[model samples]
Target: MKEFRAAVEAGDFEGLGELLAEDVVFRSPVAFKPYEGKPIVAAILRGVGRVFTEFRYVRELADADGGGSALVFETVVDGVSVNGIDLIRTNDAGLVSELTVMVRPLSGANALATAMSAQFDQIVAEASGASS
Candidate 1:
């Protein structure tokens, strides 16, 4: 969890990727379908790092059984202040296997959805351009 927090603080996508399992799943606040696999999850996380500003963790709680962790955070997205929580579950190998994100406030969620959609589009465009 320390490594995960450090990676998040540093906005290091590569470092975060290293901490995730190959079959990691990411549940988004806006998206209906949870993103599956490391590559897709990594891309979404990278986009989130870009979209969220003034992000800070408010609280962190580890399960007594050491099975998972919950982190509460606050951030600004598209000029809207938002509160969020990250529920992370790790596998036996200590690699993050699942991460669920929940955000609050309707306005903030809307703003975040817009921003993330744009980020994902940009990512797709860049990847396509690179492939071309």
Candidate 2:
């Protein structure tokens, strides 16, 4: 969890991927569909890293069994202050298999959605161009 926090705090987007499992799943705060697989999940995480500013983790609680943890954080997006929680579940190997993010208030969630949509579009365009 320390490594994960360091990566996020430092905005090490590439390094974040190393913490996820190959079949990782991500549940976004505003998105209805859960993103599946490492590539898409990683892309969303990277997009979030780019979109949010002044991010700070306020609290973290790890399960007694060490299989899961929850981190509460604060950030600003498009000038809207947002409070969020990340619920992370890991496999026996300590690879994150599921990550669910919940953010508030409504204004911040909307701002995040708008920004992330643009980022996702750019990611798609870059991937498409690379394959061409």
Candidate 3:
């Protein structure tokens, strides 16, 4: 989990690419859509980059299911500090197959929602271009 957290905080898509399944699925809190496949995975990160700057992790819990894990992160965006939780599942090869995220404080959810919505659009645009 630390490895994945490091890769995500550093925005290292290449390193992350090596740790995700080819048929991976990423689910964001906003829009309720899941991004599937590696290309879309990269796009997901690209979209997040636009909103978050100082993404420092704070607390982490070991795998809840005895294998899959939960991670907590604190990030600064637009000068607001937000905490987020991630539930991740891995494949037999230790590559991430599924991911789900939850952010704290329902009050600030709107901005996070807006940012994630833009991120989804950006990822879809990128995916469309790649597919074309």
> Cα RMSD to native, each candidate?
2.3, 2.1, 2.7
TM-score of predicted structure 3: 0.81
Worst 10 residues of 1 by lDDT: 123-132
Q: Cα deviation in Å at residue 16, candidate 2?
A: 0.5
lDDT of 3 at 93: 78
Each model's TM-score?
0.91, 0.92, 0.81
- lDDT per residue for candidate 2 within 1-132, as digits (tens), equals 677778887889768889999999999899799888777777678778888999999999999988888999999998999999999999878889999999989998999999888787755553344411
lDDT of each: 0.84, 0.85, 0.74
Clashes per model (N, Cα, C within 3 A): 0, 0, 0
Measured with C-alpha atoms, the lDDT of residue 114 in candidate 2 is 92
Candidate 3: RMSD to truth: 2.7
Ranking by lDDT: 2, 1, 3
What global local distance difference test value does model 3 have? Answer: 0.74
Residue 80 CA displacement from its true place in model 2, Å: 0.5
Model 3 — which ten-residue stretch has the worst lDDT?
123-132
Q: Write the per-residue lDDT of candidate 3 for residues 19-126, one digit (tens) a residue.
A: 778898988766577878977886776667668777876777886555688888877666666788888888887888888878766644567777767566667887
In terms of TM-score, which candidate is strongest? 2
Clashing pairs in 1: none
In candidate 3, how many Å is residue 92 off? 0.3
